[model samples]
Target: MQTLETMRSLGLLTPEQYLEITAYVMVNSTPEQILAMPPHLWQAVMQADALLFPGGPAEPVH
Candidate 1:
């Protein structure tokens, strides 16, 4: 399943609100930054085990 689809399946994201939020975050942040965020912001990154990919697994950001 796609990341977006999985998010929906897990009830983290919904069809109605996905586009707006996706647009906002996509425009304002890099996948690297989002990948580094704590779960309180978006648990899906951690839950999806993507913390270690295309960005530091858990490296401190300077």
Candidate 2:
């Protein structure tokens, strides 16, 4: 989950988004594979994270 930590630090994902995405990865992939995923692939996941979660992305914070 270090990549997730990095993603959070980078502001690509909020804490809630990180938790949701972490669960998705845990269910869909082996830990070893997740650790091996390239940075670019992680970026793709970040891009899609909000959409992948149930109920989708939040309505704007405004």
Candidate 3:
């Protein structure tokens, strides 16, 4: 899997959420799609989902 710089660095996603993102994309996307995706795009995707950071972004609680 492509290890794109994830949103974890931004302190938005918990470690668990970061792993889930990696796994989610791995299961849902082609290797080419994953590799071609920019870090900002990944950030945008993660931020848009409440599931990724539940409790409405109060803190990084997996």
Candidate 4:
């Protein structure tokens, strides 16, 4: 999994852009891995996850 910092350093994206992508990924990705992400990415992931999983937030309930 590529981190936002890593993507930024690689010039693949800005921090904000990466955050947005991360959020998108969270919404589509399975719950186990999304839940495993580090704290820094949690908010972005959750936002995306919510958007993607509009029926409900992705789980392990966080």
Clashes of each: 0, 0, 0, 1
* Model 3 stretches with alpha carbons more than 4 Å out: 1-6, 30-62
Tell how far residue 41 is off in model 1, in angstroms.
8.8
What's the candidate order when arranged by decreasing lDDT?
Answer: 2, 4, 3, 1
Each model's C-alpha lDDT?
A: 0.54, 0.68, 0.59, 0.60
Q: Which of candidates 2 and 3 reaches a greater TM-score?
A: 2
Model 1 pairs whose backbones collide: none
In terms of TM-score, the best-performing candidate is 2
lDDT of each residue in 3-59, candidate 1, tens digit only:
655665556665644454465567658778656554544564444346224463767
TM-scores, all candidates, are 0.33, 0.44, 0.39, 0.36
Candidate 2 similarity to native, TM-score: 0.44
Query: Model 4: which ten-residue window has the lowest total lDDT?
Result: 44-53
Residue 33's lDDT in candidate 4: 65
lDDT of each residue in 5-62, candidate 2, tens digit only: 6766677777777776677677669878776656755665657565445476669977
Residue ranges of candidate 4 with Cα displaced over 4 Å = 3-5, 30-62
Residue-wise C-alpha lDDT for candidate 4, range 1-62, written one tens digit per residue: 45455545665455686766667565758778666666656655455445544688436745
The collision pairs in model 3 are: none
CA error at residue 7 for candidate 4, angstroms:
2.0
